[model samples]
Structures are given as structure tokens and as C-alpha cells.
Target chain A: MRQILSQFGTDCDSGAAPRTMENWYEHREMIEINIVVCIKQVPGTTEIKIDPQTNTLIREGIESIINPFDTYAVEEAVRIKERIAQQSKEGFSGPESKVIAITMGPPQAENILREAISVGVDIGVLLSDRALAGADTLATSFTLAKAIRKLEREFGKISLILCGRQTLDGDTGQVGPELAQQLNLPCLGYVIEVMEIDNKYFKLKRLMEDRYEVFRVPLPAVISVSKGINEPRVPSLRGAMRAKSAPITVWRVSDLDVKSEEVGLSGSATQVIKVFSPHIERQSEIFTGDVDTQVEKLTQKLQSLGVV
Target chain B: MDYFLSDEQKMIVDIARKIAQEKIVPVRKELDEKEEFPHEIIKEIARADLFALFVPEEYGGLGGRIFDVCLAVEELSKGCLGVATSYAASGLGFLPIIISGSEEQKKKYLSDLASGKKLAAFGLTEPDAGSDASAIRTSAVLDGDEYVLNGTKQWISNGGEADIYTIFAMTDKTKGARGASTFIVEKGTPGFSFGKKEEKLGIRASVTRELIFENCRIPRENLISREGMGFIIAMRTLDKARPAVGAQAVGVAQAALDESIKFAKTRHQFGVSISSFQSIQHMLADMATQIEAARALVYAAAKMIDSGAKEISAASSMAKLFASDVAMKVTIDAVQIFGGYGYMREYPVEKMMRDAKITQIYEGTNQIQRNIIASHLLKSA
Candidate 1:
């Protein structure tokens, strides 16, 4: 589904549809959303090729993609905005909603920012600069919180933040919660189902280790989505064409009102000294015989291993 | 993914996903439990202007290509088969009027049905005659300015909820299939009463009931074509509706495959996710392969129809058979992957499996489809 994001406070029925950006603060339905999507652009899995010599992933010739899980996060934010806008039109113009997708990556990461626009996001911000590179979870959150503050200055106050539970490449589920902490937003992790969201609060059903928990979090909260929260809609052709030229706002550390020392490697609390693939042992014993013989052999092996 | 939907096709999928998730998804369980028709969802679909897709633009319809319709049906069925089938049967009921109805008839019925102001149903199957639709027991006797219809039609989708019904009955009893004729039966006619609704294994939200025509009379203009062309019209209609049923089945199977793949990757069973095991991986690969194959055939059949191609009995039957069978297999495997949890009502996959089983039985059962394929192959030889 296409997501729609507009600012709160404008009278939509009073010919304000065309001039959405200027008077967004007037439409109440466009108001309380602080949709901060922590998105990252990585190599497309299908486009990635393996280097035969070093057993490493070849980055060249591979097209970059917005992390698969993060797309759902952006979509959920857009959906919330659309719901609010639609509801506002039906006389419940309480507090409005806005979707702002924020990413911390290289300059080229702006492509995914535009992609998010095609999915119905209103604003895109790229946190880029030499000082923002090589940041760990702590520094990433610190940089993101600064960007959020700047977004608040431009679009008024924000109420909700959303992000993917983990990026595919990093596989670290820490960034979303850490970013929530930096912004002082109440955080809900592994949210599989979003039951309802009104102006003041939103209810969510989060998947836990053994059972699911339903919680109602106040505004200015953070939620990270797991896969299967909802099926992500494909981008429309018109949306994709429009996204091709969508302007993406870029921000450096100086623009975000952050101390230079509070970013990059300096602000990071944890650092990986070395990176290597884990060793996997494989000792194959072929059972080339009748099915009964193979079964018997398998049973004997299981018994010997104390698995039976 | 590339095998099924193109970049353009994905747009339709996106719209369908939005509609399914926002409009249809919320009411699915309640509609099923209450056995209530999704009147609101239908209005929303019409508001989106999707119902008129098959109708030509000259008739104030969207005139969308068949592939687009399939994409829409597939996505909608993923949310709930009953609702999707109810929406899809509009095309089945209206196609006859579109292909053969006069401009006046099109203006009178198609416009309202397409605009979502009224519902329509197709009445071809009787309790005694389902696979053998030629053996219709309903008889329509023409007397000067009117034809009186008297018989019962079973398993009519949309049944009493429809404002208009395209009915098939025997005009001349001696002529077998050729003697059959089609008529448009408007609701509120005297002697027209609905029978008890059928409680089925799946597609529960859609109303399927028998229509009893006791001396029901309509103007001679209500006849869709000449007195002896109902069988041909119905056969042609099935050629189109069969592919749509295939699309619905593929949607159900796709939902199963997606859920299974996600569960396999996360649910651990022996110190690791089951997806990491070769046995589970092989199951997923097989399910994916079948889905791709079925999708290809369904789209191919749909494209052929959109191109205004001649009769393609073999292609339609093959697509329906492959898709329905794949739905059965994929859903079974999905249930197995979820272990005991899959059989529970809380999970969506179990319901999808139940929904998938009916596609094999309806729109010309897979058995009948196989017969059509075999006959076509032998005749060519």
C-alpha cells in the first residue's frame, strides 16, 4: 500500500491540498508523527557476487538496496500517516502525522531515501559526512538523535519512531533500542503486530521468546518491526518514476548541532578488532545402499551419539 | 518473484496489497464467523474502480488487462479467499453480458454491477449437474413476450445477495447442451425465492445458495443470446474464470510458502533454525519451485485471453490443474513446517490450507480439467 505523510494543522478541505508543505502544521491529523526510520543501504543479495580467490563478497557490480527489513519499517510509518490523514478527513482531525525517514550512510545511500518516497514517505534525510563513517551502535544512535532534533526544528515535534529490528548485513539488533534511548523514547522491540494508533497513543502486539505481549505506548515512542509485521507492498511504476528525481536532503555533522567528538569512531563504545568467518567442519559418510540399510546405519549413529 | 509479476504488474500488486491489508484484512475473521457478506469491502473495491476492469472503456469500465485482474485477485485472496472469490465472481457473472449482451443490456446491468451499486451472480451449476453443466434441469419456456423460468440452480456465488442473476436453463429439452439458453433474472420478481445457503469447507464468507425459479417470468429481451447458445457462452466464460480461480489458488499457496519460509528461518528445533538444515531447505526449495511454475502457467493463460486468442482448452485446464495442486501441496508442507501450531486457528497458514482445498473442487474440478487436457491431447494426436 502507498503510504501518505503530511504535517499536522492545515485545513485540508480549504484548498490546502496543493499547498501541503507550507501549511502542514495547521492540519491536526498531520501532526504528532515522528516517524524516524533507521534505514541502511547495502548490496542487493541477488546482485552480490563471491570472490573465488579470497572467499569474500565482491561489492562492485552489485546494486545497493535499502535493507529488506527496513522497508517494512518505512512502510509502517507511511501507513500510520495515511491512516491518520484518512481519519482526519472523516472528522477526527485530532493530532496529525508525518513520516520522516532518516538514514546514516554514504552519499550514494540517498537512493534508498528516494525509494522510500515512492512508498509514500513525505521527507527523507541522509546523515552523511566523513566524521559519521565507521560508527558503532552508540555513535550511530548519537548521530541519529542529532538528526531527529534537526527534523523537529523543521517539522515541529515528533511523537513516534520506527526502525527495522536488525539490518541484514550487520545482524545486530542493538541499534534500534540504543537509538530510542538516545532520544529518550520508550522502546518496544520485535513488534510483529500494530493493533491501533490514535493521536495520543498507539497499541502494539510484540512477539517475545514464548508468548506475544500487547502494550500501549505513549507518543514520542520507538518501535522496531520484525519481518512479517505486514506484507510490504511493491512500489508502483508511477511512484518509482517520481522517486527517480526526488530530492534527498543531506546533512553533515556540523548541520546536526552535534559535537564532532560525539560521532564517528570516537563516540563508539564497542569496536571489533578483527573480522573473520567461523570455521564449519564437515565429515561426510555416504550411505550407498538400500533404504533399510541406510536407516539402520542412521539409527546406529544416532544411538552412538546419545541422540536416540 | 520475477517469474510472476513484472515491474508494471507489481504496481497492481501494490494496490491490491493495500486494499487487502487496509480494507479486507480487518473484517475477514468477523465476516467468516458471522457469515456476513462484505458489503463495505465491495463498496471500497468499487470505489477503487476495480470491478469494471474486464469491461471495455466504452462501457465506462477500467478496461484493465486480464493480467492486472489476476494480480488483484491473487493479492486479495491472500487476505481471505471468501472475499476475493465474491469479488472475482462479478467478472464471471458479467463476462457473458460483455461478450454477447446488447448495448442496452450492457447499459442496464453491467453499469450498476461495475459501479458497485449492485451485485451480480452466475447460475450454471445445479445440484444434479456440476461438472456436467450441460445437464441443467432448469427449463425456460418462451410464451410470446416472456419466458417463464422454473428450476433450481445450486452453488450460485453471491446468490441472494445479488441484484441480477445470469441464469442457464433448458430452452428445448431434446437438444442436450445445444438446447440450453441463458437468461437474466432480476431480483424481486414474483415466484423467485432463494434456497438455504450451503455450509462449505471453505470460502465461507461468500454466499453460495440455490435459486428456485417457480414460473419466474422475464421479458424476451432478457435472453443473453439466441435460444441455443448458453452452453457455448458458459464454456467460454469458464475458460476465463478458470484462470482466475487458478490465480486465487496461487495466492493461497503463496501465502503458505511465505509463512513457512519465515517460520523455518526463525523457529529452532535442534539447536539451530530448521531452515539451516538441508531437509527443511529442500522442502522450501520445492515449494518455491512449484509456486513459480504455477504462476507462469496462470499468467500465460491470462495473457492469451487478453490477446483475444482463440479457444485454449488445454492451456486453461493445465493452468488450473497445476495451480490448484500446487496449492494443496504447498499448504500441506506449510502446515508440517509449523508443526502443531500450524493446525491451530490463530495462525493464517491453517486457514489458507483450508481455503486452498476448495479451488481444486470448484470452477471445473481438477478431475474435469484433467479430462479436458487428455481429450485435447488425444484429438491432436
Candidate 2:
């Protein structure tokens, strides 16, 4: 660190004025929003089988599609961008908005990227490599966080990172919050509506089990959206044509500066010993009596079971 | 059942079917009951580039023809014949531009229609001009740079909704059919207005209204082809479009058949499923067979039109005639198969039957279609 500072000092000493870290770069308020949306491709159907030995999903025959929930995220992102444009037209625009969707998968996964672009995404990036094969949620988040940092550097500061609350195949929704944690940013999950947004803060409606909760969180945060955010629009003819020929940026493990052990199954924090489907073990009791008698017996049974 | 559709054709079916099933089916009942237009679904169709199936690739379309349009119409009709009618009406509106418009007109209007930015409606039918199209009273008189249009178009589908209109009117009434000329009119012209939405027994999801053009003046440039070509343009456009109506009939009949088969399997009587009965089985078989035959004929006719086959008017009339009659019969049988439940509004067969009635009546009544088919037969070898 001393040697590097001295070299910098010697360069400044060559007839340059004294400079401090604070004064080295000019500071300006940001009005443009560069967003990163994390999306994934999952099987079109849920009738996927799990390999007993690997305890992993067997995806050879099934067709792929954008995770249904992620379409809501894509829709919300486009809505946000449109809202920004609408604000500008009304002279109330706070931040310029652009959306970039990224997915980590095999080469064929690029189709989902094009699908995203067809729905109004500005561009797409694929983090594809053999090293990203069997990543559990944690490793997946770690890898995604790394790519986001790289994107933030390449395309200015990112205002927000959007994601689906949960993927269809992996019902575990740890990736969104985990990515926020890995990047040390605020995480807002289960967002159903974005009531207000600007460069500074965003007012969001988050869905709970019984009710919806509202939060006013600052921008530059990671947000996961539920399906209720908005209905996804169909791809416009022009948008689809544009997406067909649109160029997508591809990044490998080396490009993202991620080590092999930190991404794939080797770096996963948990291991699955077995994979199986759960079935309900239902038992029924039949009452033999007239309707009134059956009702009385049912009430007595409920009272005995303490369910009343 | 097998049309041996190419991969692209099959893909068109799959995409349209997916949209119809996922988007249209859910709200079809409500749309019918409320008589509401499906603005959002049409936008979805636009987004999916289905509207581009009608125009050529040079005009910002998918470069497909009537066959492709039929494929999509059949799938969409499965969801709701009314919605399908709205889309088909828009195609009918702009098809004149494709068939007869000059390069400048095509350049100016076709792209917008092709891209789904604007919707279109045809304005040829009048209260007095049902089968005798040459008798239309709508008049367009030239005045310097414009032609003043005076008349009304009755039962115009997408009447109040579409932004563009292709209207037929008499330029020189003394010349009879030769006096007719086609004109492209915008929806919000100074003297153009619409009447109240008409109530219908079926296809209630679609709107039917009257277009009143009282001293409506349009640019002379809007005249399609020439002053005396209106009837020819209208005829040519209908020749290209009749097979699509046949496709719609096929789709609606297929939907009825689909509901009947599903109902039959679960409905039980005499301690066995009704599907097990020979009479019910025969009805189901006949309905399926009729739909398949209708589909085949519609596809064959659409192919002939697309291929530029000469004297295709007869084939077009045959497809529309046969398929519509088949649709009416199949839907009735579907109701019959459903027994008492079929008469109830809870089931969809009754609505299918109502929708089937219009396919036989519109474009050209089945009687007119028969006349056309016989005329061509008498002239051929």
C-alpha cells in the first residue's frame, strides 16, 4: 500500500498540485438509475424427476421457460422504467432508469434473456460456465453478488437489484436476501407493489401471510417481488424482433473473478442426501347415522380433539 | 386430425393456442356476458406479432397469408368466437389496402396495421345491401382534393373501436358496379360517427355498431385503386377472407366438441358414464368428424387463396359454406349430448351455437355462398 501511494505521490509531484482522496474525484448527485435484475430459467412444468444418486433434478427431457414468478419481477422493472419516463414527461422525473437482466445457466438459458428483452429489458447478461453447474442457493447468491459488483463498476453505480421472491424449482427463496447480505445492502422481500420511487427512496407494499405491509426503504437496495406486483405483458412484435437479434453479454467464472470452489456444488454450504416427494397420509372417519345424529357426533368429535 | 403442419405452422398454432388458453379462456364468459371488448387481449396478440400474420413482410408484418391467419383464428376461436371475430374484422378492414392500395398507401398505412399500432374495420355492408353488395347506397363524390362520402355502414364489426376503416362507396352511381370505389377512412373524421352497440344472442364479446358518414370528406389519395374498382376490391378482399371465417367456425365447433367430450366422461346415468352409451358415443364421433372435416376444408381453401389460384371465389365460398353449416350442426349436437345441462348458461355449448349462426350469415350468407359455388360449377368443366 505504501509503495503504491508513493508511486501515486511521485506522479502528483511532477508539477501537479497536492491532492487528497476526498478531492481526487469530483462528486455529483446521481439522477440516472442503472438496475440489475437477477432472473433464472426453470423447467416449464413441475413434473420434474430427481436422480436418486445425485439428489438433483433430472432436466434432460423437460422444456425450459423463465421461472413464472420472475416474470413478475421483469414486469415490475419495466413498469418502474416506464414510470420514470412518465415522470420526466411531467417534469417530476427523479432518476433515469434502465434495466439489465442477468441469468446464470447453460448456453440455452440465453433464450430466457431474449425473453426478458422482449418484455422491455434494455439488455441481457449471461453468467455461464461449467463451473456454475450444481450451485445451491448460497453459492448461487455468492456468484450473483460477484457479478453484480462487476456490473456496478462497468455500468456506473446500480440503483437497485430486482429478483423474483422464489424460483419454481428451488422453492427456497434464500437467494435474494442472501445476495443482499453478501453485497452488504438492504433487502426488501415479497414486494407486491411499488407505491413511490425516486433516486433516494422507494415505498413498497410487501405481502405477508395474512396481510400486506408497507415499507419506505432507501434506493441502492436488493428487492424481491411476488407475483402480485403486476401482470406481465406479452412481447410486442418489434420487441421480440429486437430481442431476437439483440447482443447479450456473457461472463464466465474467470470473467467474474470467482473461484471454482466458491460457485459450484463444491462450495455449496449444504448437501442433499436424498430427494423425494412428500405425500399426505390422509385418514378418514365415517359416521353412521341420520343427518342430525351425524352432525351431533361430528361436534362431539371436534370437541374431543380440542379443535373447536 | 393431422394437417401435417410444418414446424413454423405448428409453432403458430402453439403460440396462439397458448395465448387463447392462458389469456382468453379465463375471461371469455365475462366478456360475453358483459359485451365488453378485449382491448388487453388484443394488445397481447399485437405483442405476440399475431396481427402481423395478415400483412406482407415488406410492410412490417410476418409475411404470412390467409393460411397463417386461419391457423391463429382457429386457435383463438376456441377461446371465444367473439374475440376471434373482433380480430378477423380488423383483418377484413385492412385487407383491402393489402390487395389494392398503391405503394404510397401501403407505405403510409400497412405498417401501422401490421405492427398493431392501429386497428382497422371494413365498411361495405349496409342495411339494404346484404347479398346484393353492388346496391350499396354509400356515395363518394369528388371535390377538388377530396371526395365527400355520404352514407352509413350497418353491422360493422369493430365499428367504434378500430382507428382505420376501409369503406366501399359508389363513385359514379350511373355505372352500376363499375361506379363503386373503395376509400380508406380514418375513424375520427369530421362527419364520421357511430351508433349504439347492438345486442346479440351470441358473440356478445364482440361489438356490432353502425358507422354513419354524413358528408364525410377524405383525401382523393385515400381512394384505393381507381374510382370504379370498389366492388372488385371488396370481392377480392372477401375471397381472401372467407376461409378465415371458416377457420373461426372450425375453432368454435372444436371448442364445443371439447366441452362435450369432457362433460360426457364425468356425467353419469343408469349407473354408468354417459360416454359409455352408444348414442352419445356416436354424437361425439360425428362432432369430432365434422370439426376435422371443416378444418381440412378451411385449410385447403386458405391454401388455394394464398397460392393465387384462379377462380378461387368458389373454393372460398365452399369452405365458408360447409364449415359454417358443420359448426351449426356440431354445436347443436354438442348441446344434445350435454342433455339438460347443455341448455343452461353454465355450459358453453349454447353460446357456441349462437356464435355459429353468425358465421353462416356474415361475409356472405350461406345461401349466397351456395349461389357463388353453383355459378362457378356451371362455368367450369
Candidate 3:
């Protein structure tokens, strides 16, 4: 019975019933699982202005915050880790899981990573380098994938990769899929819920245009979560203090062993040729009459507009 | 104008403001109407590690200073002074331990208090002890390894809800103020009970009950500092905490001013916004100026206390006195700006006015604060 139960959750379970402590030890190895969550810090305010000349954002005085959508992804990852821990406590014998938050931006991006730690992320990694500036989505995804690979090398196997469907600043909704391609893993987009997980496979609920679909995929997959997945928790004071003192591992282009050219603007496959705000045109008409006459006029107007 | 907060302090302010806006604001009115303790909000605050702000990190705290606590209190008070009082009053109860507890005592008590696992209350006020704390009639007599205490502490915040209490009693009545001693008593101790809760004009969300100790026995080791040090400890604690009350006052005052400005801008009379009237503008100007001055004084006093200044009695008293007065005046002006609407309970300024009055009364009345300031000035002269 124990052997049958073991196969349901563990990879090291052999087809043998353990009769001694030594035999039990030989049958299983304590699985270590790490979840990598991607986060981005965007300007706090929506009243952004683009420099007409440089075609760049005016970020000199604006406050920055973790991308709002990304917070949902981070929250979902923490929730999944917590669930796994709870299951472990209930004799599930699941792997010990840790949520690791990763970000690629200026050195100040470490602030978002610190925030992630303050809200239950176990580790934080910042991919910061002057050379990585001006990268488009493709190059950005490559750099992040390289950083994830570096994290894996240091912290052992990563069981899951999570990201927000899109960032507020970029809103491209492309990085998650591109990173999934770069890492050669099965990718699921618009994930709204995590149904179940074990050592070998996991189940996720992906949202579609008009409905939701559940899918079971193998371990070590990439999942891009939507904003509706979960409500993020506020950082506890103890968590904040811990994050204040927590050591964030800062990795540069050199640290990831990636070619400098492929990581920054030089490796980008796309560039913005022009940027401008679209002008909106408006027109209005007023009908002056009694209520019945006004209703007749509105009907005639709608009919003239091909309404019937 | 040159007041600068550290990055950590700024982060604390941001977190506290978020809590006030997101968590406290929604339930503030209901809590006041129901006269309910904000248990969930307090838990949230504790989870955020705010309770540990003034606690040293060595004792499982964030190791923040009095300035940090003032910043947090001000932000929370902006949402509701009643809820803020519950938070600030806990800090008041724990200050004696932080200020005078021995290493062993600190280790035993400060850790849980800092972690917010247990709420604490200060028991110094009685029917006869208001303003004149030296007149407390509570008595504590030594018997074997324990001290038997008998007293009724009135109008104590967090009275029945708190788990630990720092109570003062006269050990030798012949010595007057010097006869008193402070002791740490747990809630479950036999003969320790609470009296009827008081219905108040404002800050109604906070519990104000009588702490009745009838032959309450506690370990002699529970005595903080030494015999006859209760008065000194109480005074020192109040001096440090007075600015926190000032911060609370500033918060309520600022809230009232903000409401008035918004109301004035939207309210119209004779085809023009009331805000466009020079008379209303002048009232707003005076309110804003006084509030700024009060805030400056409160922050300066808090900073001085955090800087370990020994002679801050005058500054603390001044901060409390000026800020509480400004709170009352500003709130009243805010009501006037609202006209008849402000007089109605439907508006918030009236509630603010009620809350502001307590700041003047509690933690040593404004009158007592004036006395303290004058005594310090005369002594210095």
C-alpha cells in the first residue's frame, strides 16, 4: 500500500514495501522544487509622457512599482508553493518548494525583487547590466531565459516557470511564449488556476475567449497566469524586515555566460521606427423638440444610419 | 522643510498608508458605529510587523524607533482615530517594558509584544489618578516571592482585550509619588478582572474599561526596574509617547482639512464655489498653516525622542499641546466650511472633531501638558 501510494507523488518510489528505516531511506530522496516567477517594475502613474524628440519615456521623476499584472503571477506562484507546503504537512510527501522571483532591468529593479521577497518569495535574483539596455521583447526574453538557466544551475532543478500574461509598460503578451520557446518547455497561456500537482505532472486551468479548459502537462513547464488568478498578499512586517536584509543575487550578462551581443539591443530583432499618439475625432448632434417629437427624430436618425 | 525620512522609514509610511486606505477605511465607520474593536485590522498590522517598529530586533522586532512609530500612527490616524488609538495605545502599554524592563524581562515580554502575538495595556489611571498620576490609590504589598496588588484602574485602553498589563500601585503610600511601583501582570491571573466599558464621545472603536485588581498576586520578579521608580517610568514613557498622540492629532486634522478643501471646491452659493470666496479661503489658509506647524513640532519631538534626548519633556508637551489644539480648531473650521452639512453626523468632520477632543484629554490633558512645559521652562531659567 505504501509503495502504491508512493508512486502517486514521488519519482524515486520503487516497487517495494519498506520493512526497515534503511529501506525507506533508499526508496525516496527528498525532492527539492523551485518556482521561478518573472516580475517587472513599471512607472506607478498612468499619466506618462513620451519625449517627442527621443521617443522615450520621461522617467526622471516618476515613481516606479511592480507591474500590476505581474503581481497576480507572483501571488499565484506563492499560493501554489503554500498549497504544496500544506499538502506536505498533511503527509503528502511532496517536494519542498521555494518561490524564486527573477527580474531583468536596471539595478533599481532590485526593489521589485525585494518586494517579492517581502510577500513570501524565498529568493530574489536581479539580472542587471548596462549592456542589456534597449532590448526588445525577443532580446529581453532571451536574457531572462539565460538568467533562469543560471538560477537553475545554482538552485537545482526548477519545477515551474510563471509570468504575467503581459506587462503594463510593454503589454506585448509575447515574452512568456518566447521564453517558453527559448527554454524548450511546454507553455500554457492565460492560466487562471492550478488544479493539482505531483512529482511527474501538473494540471492547470487555462482561460479562453468564452470558456475555460483544464490541461494536464508534464513537470518543468512554463505557465503565464492572468490577473484573475489570485489576489496578492500584502507583505507582513516581519517579511518586510527580512526582505530589507535579505541578500539579492545580482547577475550580469557575464554572470549568465551569454554573449553580450545577444543579450542587449544589439541582439534585438525588432526596433520602434516611430511613436505617436493617435488623434481622436468627435462629432455630435442635438435634437430640439417635445418628448414625442424628439423620440421620432431619434428614430429617424437611427433609421438614416441604417438601423431599421 | 528639511525633514528627511530614511528609505526604510519611507517604506514603512507607504505600507501603513496602504493599510489605512485599503483595510482600515472600509470598516472605520462601521467599527465606530458598532463600537467594535478592530481585531482584524490589528492582526493585519501585526502581520505587517508594524507592532515591532519600536521594538529592538534582538527581541524579534523590526528595531524601529519612536519616529517610525509616529509616522505609522499618523498614517493610520488619517483613516480613523479610533482605530489608530487602539494601535497607539498598545505602543503606550509596552513602552515601560522597553524603557525599564531588565534583559530577562525584556526577553520574556518584549518578544511577544513586538511580534504582536499579544496585546499589552498600561494601568496607571484611576478615578482619582487622572492628570495627577501620583495620586493613584492602587496598593501592592510584598508577600513571600509575590506582590499582592489591589486597585481599580479606570479608563484604560485595551483593558479587557489585552493579554499583558503594566500596572502601577503604591508600595509605600507615606512617600507620596515615590511610593509607587510598576509590575507586569498577565490577564489570566486570579483576582484580575475588568470593569464596565466606557461609552465615549469619539475614538469609540477603542475599548476603555476599568482594570480591577482585587488581591491580585504576581511574581515579585515581574517588578520592572525597582520600587519607587513607577512615577519616573510612567513620566518617561508619557514624554516619549506624547508626540505619538500629536501625530494622531495631525492625522485627524489633515483628514478634516482635506475634506474641507474638497467640499469647498464643490459646494456652491450665489453662482460661485464657496472655495472662490475669500472668507473660506482665509479659513483654509489658517487651518493649513497651523496644521503644518503642528506637524513640524510633532515630527521634531518624535525625532528628538528617537535621538535619545533626555530633556524632551518641554518639546513633547509642546508638540502634544499644539497639535491637539490645531486638530480641534481645524476640525471645527472644517465643520463650519461644510455649513449645516458638517453639523450632521453624515459628514466626517464632526467625528474628527470628537476624536480631536480626546487627544487633548488623554495621555495627560492639555492643561497638564501646559503645566509640564511651564515647569521645564522655569527650571531651565
lDDT of each: 0.82, 0.89, 0.88
**TM per candidate:** 0.59, 0.87, 0.81
Q: Write the per-residue lDDT of candidate 2 for residues A10-36, one digit (tens) a residue.
A: 758886777675554332223477888
Q: Could you tally the backbone clashes for each prediction?
A: 20, 0, 2
| Candidate 1 vs 3: which has more lDDT | 3
lDDT of 1 by residue, B24-62 (tens): 877777777777888877776775556766667777765
Which lDDT tens digits does candidate 3 get at residues A1-308?
A: 56535554354354445345434444554445689999988889988766665454555677889999899988888888877776566444644688999998888888999999988899999988988877888998999998888888888899899999998876799999999999999999999988987767788999999999999989798999987888676687667778999999998888987898897778788876567679989878999989999999999999999988
> Which prediction has the highest TM-score against the true structure?
2
Model 1 in CAPRI terms: which quality? incorrect
The residue ranges of model 2 lying beyond 4 angstroms of the native Cα positions read A1-34, A43-64, A81-99, A105-111, A114-133, A150-158, A195-205, A208-219, A236-255, A272-283, A296-308, B2-7
- Name the lDDT of candidate 2: 0.89
Off by over 4 Å in 1: A1-308, B3-8
Fnat of every candidate, listed in order: 0.04, 0.38, 0.42
Q: Which residue pairs collide, candidate 2?
A: none
- Against the native complex, each candidate's DockQ, computed on alpha carbons, is 0.06, 0.29, 0.39
Model 1, range A10-50, lDDT digits (tens) per residue? 34445565555445435444335657777988788754554
Error of 3 at B372 (Å): 2.8
Q: Write the per-residue lDDT of candidate 3 for residues B58-91, one digit (tens) a residue.
A: 9888775888899999999999999899988888
Between candidates 2 and 3, the TM-score winner: 2
Of 2 and 3, the candidate ranking higher by lDDT = 2
Better of 1 and 2 by TM-score: 2
